[model samples]
Target: VRAEAIITRESGGGRAFHALVSSDGRRIEADLLVLSCGVRPRTRLASDAGLRTSRGILVDDRLRSWSDPRIRAIGDVAHVADPRRYAHEREVPGGPAGLVGAGWRQAEWLAGALIAGEDPSPFAEDSPGIVLLKSRHVDLVQGGEIVPDPFAPGSGEVASWADPRHGTYVAMSTTNGVLDGFVAVGMPRAAAELSLLFQRRGELPSDRSLLLRLDAAEQPVRATGRDETVCICNAVTAGGIEDAVSDGCDTVDAVGCATRAGTGCGGCRARIAEMIDEWQGQHV
Candidate 1:
């Protein structure tokens, strides 16, 4: 027997990657093939732009590159100082932690620096965040269930949810009511927020149900202070989507193709569509 793999293109794109196999005087063809892929630090552009590129673009405690005083890079494209001590020794990963919250923190610091005309210190300098991954689930936990402090060093926790049938598991280390780090499986969404809360050393909500409500909802609820990203893959916020509609991308598909808001997993597609309708109704 022989095997063949085929892949399909999205949209109205023509059929491509047709594969075939023949054995024992018979032939077999495949119309679809799926493959898992991995990602690496992409720093070529930073290098081209005259920034010092290490495993990723090396940056100072402020997330500003050493080679270029005016340039700042963030997300997976830049490497900031790692503060984790795994196995009792400081460990520096080739890439900075990759997460929507991490990027948001970086962006916020960069914006402050740009507006103030001076470099601002990295937001999560005291506590290093951790990524929790299991199968299709991922979470970032920064602080745990502690009062008076959310991210007291070693007090934060991260958990992941891979199977709804099985109870979730959370691993965390806390000290002095502060969160240090954690790895969890089966609850990434909650974990991601916990990670942020810990990094910010912000107060945890007295009612955990509020967090659950926000997480389970299909639409984003307005929260005061610090804008939350509705479409993480594109770094687009609720306000950004409103602006995009005002500037025209008047449909979910158009907004997605234009801003890549709903391109990944498509969980936010419905929300994008609703926003488009609301914008058009009010303006047009």
Candidate 2:
């Protein structure tokens, strides 16, 4: 499996793929092959057409190609090059976001611009994008600068814990007690709390160990903050959901349609439902 080079893949009759032949003449047979390599923008056609490209098709604030006004790029193939767009200190290098939420935002904006026939506000970057991986066997959530070296100059407190046997790990770094970087694996509750703190720029508990308790033995856990985000994909907060409910969005689907909260990934639907129930209980 660690062969230096995968020379060829052979397909047998009646099978989608039969075997992989390595440079060392080893033939590995498998029922499925999963390639986990990351993605790159497919700009070959644009490049052949003599369009400007750097990391992706170079675009301005309006998502129009710098080289060709007629050709616009969005989604993972756009590198928005507007220097004034990103004012944050931790801005990512200029390139395509390669994220579904970002793509949706771009599509919506572009559609509106085309329909109204007027220039809209420049598309903005969503810094510190949340990453979530949910599976039957593993759960992971990460955001921000997850690995600031504790020994580095100007770095803040860094705390970490790992339980490999239980497939659990948590690490966080704070800037003046504010959660700036974090990562969690296999600890869903802790991960959720960390995510909220990260979104709110909330201070971590003075005793970092308190977070471990949330995931330790899987005790009852809830992160209590309505101003913090719940639907990261749409940047919707618990407070936003409450407002929607107060505005007569009585059902989960109604809330989704009103705020576009649970429309993406659907990871926050249960929380949206819970918020609705809590609101109704209080009002009654």
Cα RMSD, each candidate = 11.2, 7.0
Off by over 4 Å in 1: 1-38, 42-201, 215-226, 257-260, 263-267, 277-284
Per-candidate TM-scores read: 0.43, 0.66
lDDT of 2 at 141: 80
For candidate 2, the clash count comes to: 0
Candidate lDDT values, in order: 0.55, 0.76
Question: Candidate 2, overall lDDT?
Answer: 0.76
**TM-score of structure candidate 2:** 0.66
Q: After TM-score superposition, what is the CA distance of residue 269 in candidate 1 from its true location, in Å? A: 3.3
